[model samples]
Target: MARGRKLDIEFCGFGDGWEADNKEKPESGPKETLPPPQHCLVMQREKRRGKPVTLAGEFFLSKEEEKALLGRVKKMLGCGGTLKEGWLEVQGDKAVALRHTLEAEGFRFKK
Candidate 1:
């Protein structure tokens, strides 16, 4: 529906937006080749139901990106985790390890 472009003839309303080819493409390569990251990650210790849980806070990402990042975090930590209210909660006090992992993923963080 953009620039009078026909939806039927275009790839629209999906992961990539309409007129995607017209947009500038992002540089693609190994992760380490990227710059100072696109995320500001924060980690903290929290409690729910009187049980300790580690919270990795406030990732500015869309739903799909958040889900993918959460999955990777969980898998890397080898522990159970969930996303809540735009926060990522991993089981136990995993703040230290979480910080390292996030940094490896090119995320910038502060204590």
Candidate 2:
């Protein structure tokens, strides 16, 4: 069960000159475009405590971009991974698959 109540209220007005400060201004110029970074990423496999892990290195991504890319890779590969210092470590030997996936995402790899 619920109860409802009604109350009478008058208009609520802001103080003077509010519209002048709150008005939206149009942008003046077009945003400048920048080229993508040139990072020759590499994928290698390493053994950690009797387990295999794939290390993708040489990424030039910001912290937020690294986290997002790591999440996307984990989802696409159906594996768990983490972002390390300049490396993305996935819980498996997924170098080849990771290469293919990264290539699709406009990433280049070093031999």
Candidate 3:
């Protein structure tokens, strides 16, 4: 062996004609069922110039469901909000009031 030299190696034991065989597979097995999804509303408040002026509301919902939910929250809070990247951005610090509204609408939420 030479110093700082590498040797070329080759593997030749495994069969080259290997193939997966599922001919005698069962007709069916136990079906895999996923757990029920959870619906949680998350609200956060961000401060600007030492004053809270923006509230971010995020709800886990499908794309179609998010539009309606965002509109409802914005109207209820009497504030401007937009849906972006699957999140609702309400312009103003309305975390406290928003939590109350969500709870009244049968939604479980967290800060």
C-alpha root-mean-square deviation, each candidate = 12.3, 11.1, 11.6
TM-score for each predicted model, relative to the true structure: 0.62, 0.65, 0.52
Candidate 3 has what TM-score?
Answer: 0.52
Considering only N, C-alpha and C atoms within 3 Å, which residue pairs clash in candidate 1? none
> How would you encode candidate 3's per-residue C-alpha lDDT over 1-111 as one tens digit per residue?
888887744564336875568568773455332211344667767776676654444455555567777778888999887777545677777877777776776677553
Look at candidate 3 and tell me the lDDT of residue 20.
61
Number of the predicted model whose TM-score against the real structure is largest: 2
Misplaced by over 4 Å in model 2 are 1-37
In the range 7-98, model 2's lDDT, one tens digit per residue, is 54445455544455667877545533222236678888999999999998767676677787888899999999998766889998888888
Local distance difference test, per candidate?
0.76, 0.77, 0.64
Worst 10 residues of 3 by lDDT: 30-39
Candidate 3's clash total is 0
Model 3 error, position 24 (Å): 45
Estimate the TM-score for candidate 1. 0.62
Error of 3 at 35 (Å): 12
List the candidate 3 regions with Cα displacement exceeding 4 Å: 1-37, 48-57
